[model samples]
Target: MWENKIDINQIVEIRAKTTAFFGVGAIKKMADVAKNLSSRGIKKVIVMTGKSSHIKTGAWAVTKQALEANAIEYLLYSEVTPNPTVEQVDEAAARAKSFGAQAVIAIGGGSPIDAAKSVAILISYPEKNASELYELKFAPDTAVPLVAINLTHGTGTEVDRFAVVSIPAKEYKPAIAYDCIYPLYAIDDPALMTKLPAEQTLYVSVDAINHVVEASTTIVTNPFAILLAKETIRLVAKYLPVAVKEPENLTARYYLLYASLIAGTSFDNGLLHFTHALEHPLSAVKPELAHGLGLSMLLPAVVKEIYPASGEVLAEIFEPILPGFKGTADEADKAFAGIRNWLDGIGVTSSLKDEGFDEYMVDRLVDLAFETPSLDGLLAIAPVKATREAVRNIYTNSL
Candidate 1:
C-alpha cells in the first residue's frame, strides 16, 4: 500500500551544513560526533534542552556519556521552555560565555535548538546581547558550532537556518535566518522520539504540515519545494495517526521524522507566508501556547485565504487526504473543507475560541502580525497580498 518505501532498519547519513545521522540507535553515534568536535579544538560545550523530555527519552544519557568519554567539559542549561524568550537566550548565552563554551549541543525539539542557535551566535560574539542579535542590530558572520539532538519531528530547526524567539513585554515573536546559525551536526533518532506525548506528536506533525503548505505556495517556491511538499503531506497523512495511536511504533516515528526533515528543507528553499506570519502573533501573545498548536489553529483559515491563488498546487499536494479535490479557484470552499476535515481527523478539533481567544483579540493579533519584526517579510511573500483587512479576516475566521 506504500510507494517508494523506506527500509526501517537502515540508518542513513544526510550531509549538508549539518551532517545528520538518522535512524533508530543513531544517538549512539554521539560519541563519535563528540570526538570529531574535540578534534576541531572544541574543548568546552553548553548543553541546551527543555525541562525533561531529553532525560525522559534517554537521549541525554547518551550525550552526557559521549561528552565525558571525549573529555569535553560541559554545562547543562535546562531552563528552555516553549516559546523561548529573549531573556532566556540572553541568560544562557551569558552563562556559556562566562564558562568559555566552544560549542553547543542542543538536545530537544525546536525550542531548545532555536535557543541554542541564538546562544551560539552570542558565544561567538560575546559583545552582543540576545536582543541585539534578534533585532538584527548586526549581521553575525560566524557562530560557535551547534550539534542538534532532535527529540521531535517538527520545526526542522536541526536542518533549517531559522530560529524564532519571543519578547512578551513587547508582544513580539520574530524569526531570524542566518547562515551562521545552521547546526554543524544533527541526530534524528526515531528511538528517541517514541516516548513523545500524544498531543505533542499531533501538534508537531501539524507544524510540519503548515511548513510545507506555505512553503510550496509562496511566490519564491521552486520545483524542489513542490516535490518535498507533496511527499511531506503524504507521509504525515499516512503516518501521523499511526504515531499518535502507537507512540512506541518506530516505523511511524521514522516516517513522521522524515516528513519533518523534508518539510524543513522545503521551507528553507521556498520560504513561507501568511500562516507563519499570522501564527507567530498568536503564540507571542500567549507564551504558553505551543508554536505548532498555534499554527494548527490558524492553518485552515490561512489556507482558505490562499487557495484561490495557489489552488492547483495545493489541491495536488493535499490530494492524499483530500481525495478527488479538483484544482479550481472557484472551489476554494471545497479546499477549505478538505483541510479542516483532515485537521479534525487528526484530533485537532480546537479553534481560536476553543483555545480561549475571542473577537476582542482579533484586532490585536492582526496588528501584531504586521508590527512584529521580520513578519512583514514573511507576509510579503504570500501569493495574495496580506492587507490589514485580510489579516483581520483570517484571525476572525480562525476564531
Candidate 2:
C-alpha cells in the first residue's frame, strides 16, 4: 500500500541520528546505552529531566550504575516543568557546561527530552544566541549527541529532531530543529509505562491515537500516507484502551509503543495539521493542563472542521480499517465519530470549560494560532484552509 512512498532506488537522506534500543524494561537498556557511550569514551553526562523522581526508574538506576562504574564522570540534572521554557534550556545548558558534560541523557516525557535537545545545541554552539536557534532558519554550527529514555508514548520526542520550547507571554511557541536534535539512541520499554497512573496512561495513548488520526486524515489524497495512517488508526483503536485499563498488559503496551513510533514517522514526513497547530497555543496559555489532555479536548472539534473539506478522502481511507462503516456516508461519518467515541470511551472528552478555559480566551487563542509557524503546513493539507475566523470558530465550538 505504501509502495509509492517507498522509493527503492531514490537516495532519501534522513539526516537525524536514531537508534531504537528496545528492552523488556527501561533500566536494562539504560545500562546498554550508557555502555555504548562508554565504549565511545563519553565520560561526562548531563541528565535533563522534569522531576528528580524519574531518576529512580530503571533508566535512571542504570545511569547511576554507570556513574558508579566510572563510565560516567559527571552528571547535571535539570528538573524543569512539563512545558519547558527558553530560560530553562539556558539554565540546563549552563549546568552542563559547569559539569563539563560530554553527552546528554534525557529521561522523561516530551518536555525534558525537548529541553535536552535545545540544551545540547547550546552546549555545542556556545557562541550562538538561543533565540536564533528557535527560528530554525539555519543549521546549528554544532550540537552534542543526545540519548533519550522515553517514558511516554505520544510525543515521539525520542525520534524527531524538533524541540518545542515555550516563549513566555508570546503568542506562538518556538521550535529548535536540526539534524543534531534527533536522539542518537531511543529506549522504548513498556515496563517503564506500566507504573504510570491510569489517567496519565490513557491520556498519553489517546494523544498517540490523535497523532495518527490527524496525520493520516490531513493528506488523504496521498495514497501511501493514507494507508499508513489507516493501519495506525486500527492499531490505536484495538490496543489503546487495553493499555490504559491494564498498565501491566505488555502486549497492549507494546502495540501502543509501535503505534506511537509509526505516528511519529508519519508526522515527521507529512507534518501535523490543524490539531497540533491549534493545540500548542492552548498548552502555552494553560500551563496546568497536560499536552495530551489539551490535544484530546481539541481533536474532535478540529476533526469536525476538517471533515467538510476532506470527507470523501477520509471515508475512502478509513473504510478498510473500520468495517462497521461500509457505506460511503457511513464511513465518512464514522471516521470522525470513531475519534469522539474513542475519546469518550477513554474518559478524555472534557470540554474547554471543564479544563478551566473560558470563552473570553477564545480571541487570545485564535490570535496565537494565527501566529503559529506550521499554519502553512496545516493549510496545505487541511480539509479547509483554517482562517483566523475559522480558528476562532473552532475555539468557540470547543468551548
Candidate 3:
C-alpha cells in the first residue's frame, strides 16, 4: 500500500549504467560479452552454478564455450545448494582465489548468483569473514566484475545489488547490500529456461510475484514500483501457467524472465517486507521447503495481517490495479482474494501445513526470524511492527 508521505531518503536514485541484454536466444550473447570483456583485458573469471539438473541444461554449454574460446581462465563452483550456506561461499571464494579470478560469472537461479555475489566480495576482501559480509556492516571498496546469467525468473539476483546469504553460525540470514554487488552485465535468455519442469517454473514465478507484491505494499512505496508490481502480477497470472504447462513456449518463458527482472528492480529499490522476513527462517530451518515455497505459503496470510494496519494506503494503491471493488472492504477482500485465486491457479499451496509445517515450530521459527537483519529491516518498513506474538500468530494462521 502506498502513502503520499514519500521519504526523500527512500526516493531511490535509479541509475542506468548496467547493461541488460534480453532476448529469446540471448544465451548466445553470453559468448559475445565474454569475448568483449576478454578483449577489454579481463581475464580469470569465476563461474558459480548449482548442481541441479536444471542448471546443467544451460551451464555446461556456456562453460564449454568459455573453455573453447580460452577467452578467460575460469573457476567453476558448481556445488551451490538451494539455500546456499556461508561455508559454501567461503569455499567458492577459496576456489576463486586459487584460480586468480578477476571477475565472476553466475549462471543458474538465485542460489548460485547470490553465492557468487558473496564470493565476488570475498575475492577482494578475502580477510572479511562470511558473517561480517552477511551482516551488511562492512562496506568493501572493490569487488570483482560480476556477470549474471539468469536461468530462472525468480529472485532477480542478477540485476539487484543485494545478495541474501544464509549463515548457519548465526541464527539468521542477512542481505549483503552494496553497490559493488550489482552485476556488471545481466543476460536473460529464455532458451536457457526451456528445461525447467512445471513445478519449478511455477514456484519461481510465485517467488517473483512475492518480490513485486512485497515491495509494492511496503511503507516506502513508489509509483514506478506500483506499476511494476501490477505488471508482474498480470504477467504471472497469465503466463506462469502457460510457461509451466508448455515449458518449450519461448514467449511465455521470455515474459516470465522479463517480469522477474522488473520485479527484482522494484524490490532492489524498495526492498521486501514480512513475507521475505518470515520465509527466510523457514528455509533456514527446513532446508527442503525452498525459499520460493516458503514465501508462497506465507504471502497471503502476511498480506491479510498487514492490510488492516495500512488500510487507507492499501485501498488507494489497489483501487486501480485490482478489479471488482471500489476501494472498500469488498475491494480489499477482492484484492487479497485475487492473490489467493492466482496462487491456487498456479497450484501454490497457501498454508505452511501443506508444506509440512506446524504450530509446534512457530516459536522457534519466530526466534530465528527475529535474528535476521532483513526481518528488522522489514519490520521498520511494515505498517505495523511484527511482535513475537504477531509473528507466531501469522505462522499459526499460515499453518
Top candidate (TM-score): 1
Q: Global lDDT for candidate 3? A: 0.76
Is candidate 2 or 3 superior in lDDT?
3
Worst 10 residues of 2 by lDDT: 7-16
Tens-digit lDDT string for candidate 2 (61-172): 7767766575577575757798887778887888888888888888888888898888888888876545556645457856788888888777777888767888765655
Q: Could you give me the TM-score of model 1 versus the true structure? A: 0.98
What is the Å distance of residue 116 in model 2 from its true position?
0.7
Model 3 CA deviation exceeding 4 Å by range: 1-17, 52-55, 309-322, 329-338
- Write model 3 residue lDDT over 1-399, tens digit each, in one string: 122243212213223345767766566666777887787687788889887643466655765585459557777778989888889998999888888988888888899889998998999997886777887768886788888888888888888987888887665777767888888888777778889878788789889888877787788978788778777777776678788788888778877887898889888767788888888888877777678888878876776777766555455444433554444443444556666676786687557877777888888898877877656878668656778877886688678
Could you tell which candidate, 2 or 3, scores higher by TM-score? 3
By lDDT, who's the top model here? 1
Could you give the candidate ranking by TM-score, starting with the highest?
1, 3, 2
Residue 291's lDDT within candidate 1 is: 82
Better of 1 and 3 by lDDT: 1
